[model samples]
Every structure is written in structure tokens, then in C-alpha cells.
Target: MLKYGVTHRLSTTYHPQTSGQVEVSNRGLKRILERTVGENRASWSDKLDDALWAFRTAFKTPIGCTPYKLVYGKACHLPIELEHKAYWALKHCNYDLKTAGDHRKVQLNELNELRDQAYENSLIYKEKTKRLHDSKIKNSVFNIGDRVLLFNSRLKIFSGKLKTCWTGPFTIAQVFPYGIVELSSTNGPNFKVNGHRLKQYFGGDIPPMVVPDLQTFPMDQ
Candidate 1:
């Protein structure tokens, strides 16, 4: 209901599954009421009425309804004169649920199908990514000071911090296959980096260096 962010299954004593939006909201509302009813804290009920008024007037996105409208079908019609009015709202009208077992049963069935599909999809994506990584590794062989672009992706790195693109035209100072690539920093003379991180760039293949064979003189025995 809190939009499309990926929901998690893990809930611990320390990590309860609640949105920060709700948490901060309650805290702020309480603080506002506490301030307005300072010393006479018991009169917070009066301040809460004003807070509710303020909250209802605020705007929200995606659903495009204020808290007031979400609870009540329409905005509160504030009276300029001393007449008190009651705010009324219509219930959320969507028929997303039915009698007893229907909603739960349908949801359970849908989730089961999603879980199975996710498991199968996971394997497919895993193998595809692995093949890509292996192919790159097999084709790549880095040498010193060879500049190349880094393949940056949080999904690929899994660290969620590595640059997804445009990290280095970093120079390769050393090479260690299947592991690290010692790279030189783009900075001053003090800069250096991992060998495995370095990529080799050929400035248009300058044909492999050829060497001439020299015949050795035979000595008389």
C-alpha cells in the first residue's frame, strides 16, 4: 500500500517492518500537540483537534488525496462564523475484498505463483549474469598502463555503492588473472589501484612484436 518499493520478509526485534513515513508522522504530531499544550499537557486533546485540521489540509501524492479526503470523502468545510460543523468522509470504495476466505485465498494463490516464477527467474538471471562475467574474464588480459572503461553496476558488484558507469579509464600497473588487477590512479604519482580492477586498452592493435632468430656458432670438439 506504500507504493512500489520492494517489500522485505525479514523482521527482527531490532528491524521491525514499518515505514519511516508513519513513524516520523506520529512523532511529529505528538510533538506539535505537546508544545501547543505545554505544562497543561492534559489539554493536548484540544491541540490535537487543531493538529488534525492541519494534517487534513496537507497534500499527498500518487493517490492524490489529503489525509482528510482519504479518511473523509471531501475536504473539511471550515466555518468563518462560530457555528460548529461535523466532517464526514466516505469509506474507500474499491471492492478489493469479498467474504471471509476470498481475499486471503486469492492473495495466497497469487503469491505462490509469484514465488515460483521468482525462483525460476532467479536461476535464469543468475546463469545469464555468470556467463557474462565469465566471458569478460576469459577475453580480458590486462597489462601495465593500459586504459579501459570499467563495467560499473550495483547489481553486478552487489555492494550497492560501486559506480554503475564511468568509474575509471584507470591505468593498469599489474595483472592477476581471476583475482585482482593492479591499477594506477588517475591522480598524481601517489595514485595506484587493484590489478583486477584494471582494464587493457589497445590503441588499435600494433601487431605483436616479432623477434629474429640468431644461429649460434658451433665449437669444434
Candidate 2:
């Protein structure tokens, strides 16, 4: 990648949001493979090419175009187009070597514009998605000296079903902007954690209940 001047980004462990696009693509590919392989699970490798072609040719809402079209500056010719002698198929079939070369050059020249438009469309789509997500998020408010429970996300893998994942009645030592919180525990040092991981801890002493003495009349004994 360095040889090609491409920059590489590493995502943090357990944080899928850092690489959301790659995660979504993997999920889509898994679904496509599942549908294509059906009961022939062992033949998934054989159907890989078909699955890839389908994915590349399918329209993406974010980009507002097929992946193949964005990369090649033209839509892919479907098998049906060849079988039915579509206009695109016939136009390319009649082109001589020089004519085909010139046509390809024209497409390559327009490739940059196509990519720019796709980029803009993707930005708009992401903005709308972020807005929708933000609309449903209820902002958590925390104050200094308040008690809160810290969620132990790391315990998810090996913990038993009945085990509680929340680990703390930590005191909120400081509240920072952008969902950052500093917490202090009784036996541990103060530390900063994401505010989302903390929830208001309502732990306190419960009042003792008093029962009045009951007087019984002489029984039938």
C-alpha cells in the first residue's frame, strides 16, 4: 500500500463503528453467499464469482450507482443484454478496433466526473443517516460526584448468562464535553471512560420497615 501511496487505517478492537462500511459490505456479501449456496454449502467457492458480480452490479443507495459503473465509467452488460441483442451490445459488436479504442478513451476521460458525482452522493447519504441516528439518541447527562455504573463490555465473551455485566458504583469525578467521563472507584485509581458506558447508579440505604404488634382475642381453644 505504501508503494502505491495508499494510506492504511487500523480500527480499534470491538468497535465496529470505526469500520462501518467494511462491516456492512461483509454482511451483504454473507447474505448473498447464503442465498446462492442454499443447500450446497460446500459449493460456495464455486459460486463466489457470481456473488461478486451480483454485488458489483447491484445499485448502492449511498453511491447512487452500481460499484461496477463507478469503477469502469459504464454499466456492466448483463447476460440478458447479450441474449436479447440489446442496443448497447449491438453498438459495441459493430465497433471496429479503432472505434472501440476511441470509445473507451472517451469513457476513461469521463471517469473522473462519474467518481466525483458518486462521492457527493455518498456524502449526502451518510449525512442523512447520521441525522437519523442522532434523532433517536437520548443524550445522557452526568454530573460531578454522582454515582454511576460502568458497563463491563469485555466480560461479554466468557461471562455466564446470569452474571451482571455492570461492574461499578463508581463516582463521577469529572464530566467532559463530547461524552467523556472521569470516574473514581473505591479500590481503583481514577480513570477516564466513555460516558455512554456509564449509567446513573441509584444505590442507597433502604429504610427499615416497622410492623405493628397485633392483639389476638381468646380463641375457640
Candidate 1 segments whose C-alpha is farther than 4 A from its true place: 1-8, 61-63, 81-221
* Off by more than 4 A, model 2: 1-13, 40-46, 78-80, 91-94, 143-146, 150-167, 170-194, 207-221
Count of clashing residue pairs in every prediction: 12, 0
lDDT of 2: 0.82
TM-scores, all candidates, are 0.28, 0.67
For model 1, give the 10-residue run with minimal summed lDDT: 9-18
Whole-model Cα lDDT per candidate?
Answer: 0.54, 0.82
In terms of lDDT, the best-performing candidate is 2
Residue-level lDDT tens digits of model 1 in 1-221:
35878654322122211244455467768876866787877888878878877766676442354656445444445554224423332222224556424644554566555545545665565566557755765455666667865544224534545535546666766655434555566574534333334355545557888899989999999
| Candidate 1 RMSD computed on C-alpha atoms after optimal superposition onto the true structure | 17.0
Best by TM-score: 2
lDDT by residue (63-144, candidate 2, tens digit) is: 8899998999887887798899899777666458898788888989999999999999988977887788669767889999
